[model samples]
Target: MTKRRGERPPVPEALPVPVVDAHTHLDACGAQTPEQVREILDRANAAGVDRVITVADDLASARWAAQAATWDERVFAAVALHPTRTSTFTDADRAELTALAARPRVVAIGETGLDYYWDYSPPAAQHDAFRWHIELSKLSGKTLMIHDRDAHDDVLKVLDEEGAPSTVVFHCFSGDLDFARACVERGFVLSFAGAVTFRNAGALREAAAWVPADHLLVETDAPFLTPHPFRGRPNEPYCANYTLRDIATLRDVDVADLASTVTRNAERVFNLGDVVQSQ
Candidate 1:
């Protein structure tokens, strides 16, 4: 039989608590316009998601994401050029990003870092651009949302050498347990996405078990990595449900308690007080 909201199935554990999706891309996903974004946010809000950090990978989308945040109190913006989009990083792009970061709705400087998976941009160019973004985050004093894929060593090196802002989040963390431990050692927050719910994510689950409650976070990375039982379908902000459930399971904590902890963690790391209050 299907269990109720607060009811736990026969597992001897508490029911999973609902939670806020710490990171997402509601504006870019299926929602191509302001109206669509509004609808998506409405649905997410109804699902018990307290907030979403809508990120943008390019100048146009970044602008759109930032504007969406202005219209919806639950949405916050993180502006940056994804590593794959490094070719589009021009002086004009930098100028636009600088202006966007100055806005109150823009809470972080990223979705930026290395992605050696596709080699979309030359390694040298990506490195240079990553450094530029680091400088931008430092200058703005905003949290940094990093995307390190198949380039953890280089990403960590740059972060260490250049010195990331005090608040740095490793979004959609897919690294091994060792990497997770290393990140925790450096006081970095690891934001897990839907991938954590996949049956094959044993390593991720192990890492999650070790993550400090205060440093752990959850995200949908929506429009991608839809959690299992919903995989292969278009992802949305509301899909954060599965991710939060899985995280609570891994951490061996009640979902409600975990949700409350993560909410505080996201707020502290992303400076969400003013943004959340304004919403």
Candidate 2:
């Protein structure tokens, strides 16, 4: 009933310039070992996707992501427990995440935030965990990576009440033009994934095109949200080129120029100087 990544579309051609995958899941993509991680990065690099921000959904995956970021110079990480999995959350979980968030290579504290679409976690628990994560992001001084899905209003409410970190990213941004304008007005960065390239995502594309260059970002959210002409396939960092190219074409800018802007945004937001060198 489901298609494995191997059964999905093949990798596309390389981009004109290197860009960072604003969000991804190397572990889910089957990069379980250091060698596997390197191999994946190699394929990504060949496609001009030189760096990535591997995201975590739970504590175990967060640890995996943190360790994976060290596997290569191109891999950075985000640490957090996803809102959908907060049903069994405890103080111990927060304690462990707090420690993991302090890791030097852990550039962002996120893939957190609310998700009303999934009923796995109670609304109250998800809200509480989101508040905790916001505190963690503040305490650790790391960028906050938000995973908003059908809960944009609550997500914004929490951010307003708790106050957001210095740099915040709406990973896999699914908002409409009005929502996009609202986020941009607050200086939040939006990372568009493959959904933007979908034919039915015209509103998303319009919102993306309206975003200021500095506030725009591109990601694959891999093994999922695979770009058009390959929507059913497993996504990887390498596939980000397709989304990048799409956005560039939509905005009528050079792909290289867009890449440079997004790469710089990723570098500054995550402070991944080790993985993102001057180019």
Candidate 3:
């Protein structure tokens, strides 16, 4: 049997202050049951990850994410079919997501942009689903969370053509400085994940350092993209502190200050001010 995602990586020391994980996947992290979710959150809280926005990649995961958000007050959700799954996305999936998006705890519609790196779905289908999700986000009054991997130009082009929703965020942002500038100019939030802490991620760090403080966000993208010194290990929300500390250090700012800034940004984007409070 495969090792469960929750089995690896020793939790790091807690941060000086709490911060929000702008994106994560509790299901992929192997915290599916109510007991498992509560335990996972307890460990995260100990590491100062005060709040989390768990995201989904398909219809089933979207349902799980929506339910998880209501399971714990600190948890909120982003729901959509992933780019690769777009080829199989159906009217039923759309209806399910539409209903989930209406729930107060389901705060965003996404992980739903383009992924040219994978051939699971044709470009046309991915683009079609992306446009539909963008519209759903706008209609439901939820932030549009994006997943652009190896398809930056097309992602921007589609957004330009579609007239983006009120709020857009690029989760697990994997772009260079120029692309970062393009996104920032358009007022899209760039969410940095654990990959930013890798040694080969110099360009990513540079992009992050230059992002206007208010436009920057941090995440774990956990059970994957485990941060430096733990790259091959499984990850969980408790590890967000590692990524947040690295980002603060790279930007030459105080960790606590950066924590407050990102927490504020997450709250504003997800409209979670009353939902997740500072610790």
Candidate 4:
């Protein structure tokens, strides 16, 4: 049957081992209330995606993401103003973001970096915001989650100039193999999203195949980038399971082994040990 446009994909079969959706936007996925959040997570858990890191793109979402994290033991948060939205970033915004970063369940500072694809925010503003986020990550001792879109060189340049955080993760990594090698060489973690499963993402697949287990992670980036066979559909955290299966096939590794490795990587990067234990 031809699925209608914007239809949500059916929950996939459970994975041999559970994995985490290293990045997603629960708010954008229509999970605002505690009941809504649990309903979404329950679907994901059934498909073997046991935990998730819900990322924010602005102050409002950042606040929601942090609050949502506290609501569910299986959910964590990354707070930041997205690069494209940085044009209007203010001191008041910084103060609030700093406070949000300190929240116990806010495990990362990010979804911040360059995004040349959209002109919503000027480059200068984006650069300044990205640098500030880098500092915030260091100060808070949390992983830095980057959203690099069509400005890879500048993203790395800015990080280099400001000394990257001890733990760096490129969310929804869209780079080719060469760029992947550059990030890996710098010890930055590369997180593949649903886009990696796209048929034309050959270079991305190559990079996915080459990344070492410890440096690799997977995400759904839900409410967007639905994986193949269901591309263009509405996506939620549960879809990370499908992306994980594709990556496992791409790497020619056992699905269970890959799940375990990425789950461990997610736990280490996001400091999710206690969260997982409580779950």
Q: Write down the lDDT of every candidate, Cα atoms only.
A: 0.82, 0.89, 0.90, 0.93
Backbone clash tally (model 2) = 1
The reply for model 2, stretches above 4 Å from the true place, is 1-8, 274-279
Candidate 4 residue-pair clash tally: 0
Clashing pairs in 2: 223-235
**Estimated TM-score for each candidate:** 0.91, 0.95, 0.95, 0.97
Q: What is the TM-score of candidate 3?
A: 0.95
Writing each residue's lDDT as its tens digit, candidate 3 over 1-279 gives 123444567777788879988899999988879889998889899999988899999998999999998788889999999999988878888899999999888889988999999899999999999999999999999999999999999999999999988899999999999999999899999999999999898899899889999999999998789888778778888889999999888989999999889988998999897444521
Per-residue lDDT over 38-59 for candidate 4, one digit per residue giving the tens place of the 0 to 100 score: 9999999999999999999999
Please list all clashing residue pairs in model 1, or write none if there are none. 17-255, 17-256
Error of 2 at 58 (Å): 0.7
Per residue, candidate 1 scores C-alpha lDDT tens digits across 77-185 of 9999999999657899899999999888899988999999996788888888899999999899888899999999999999889987788999999888899988988
**What is the lDDT for 120 in model 1?**
78
Query: What TM-score does candidate 1 reach?
Result: 0.91
**lDDT for model 3, on a 0 to 1 scale?**
0.90
- What lDDT score goes with residue 37 in model 1? 77
Q: How many clashing residue pairs appear in each of the predictions shown?
A: 2, 1, 0, 0
- Once all C-alphas are superposed, what RMSD does model 3 give against the true structure? 3.0
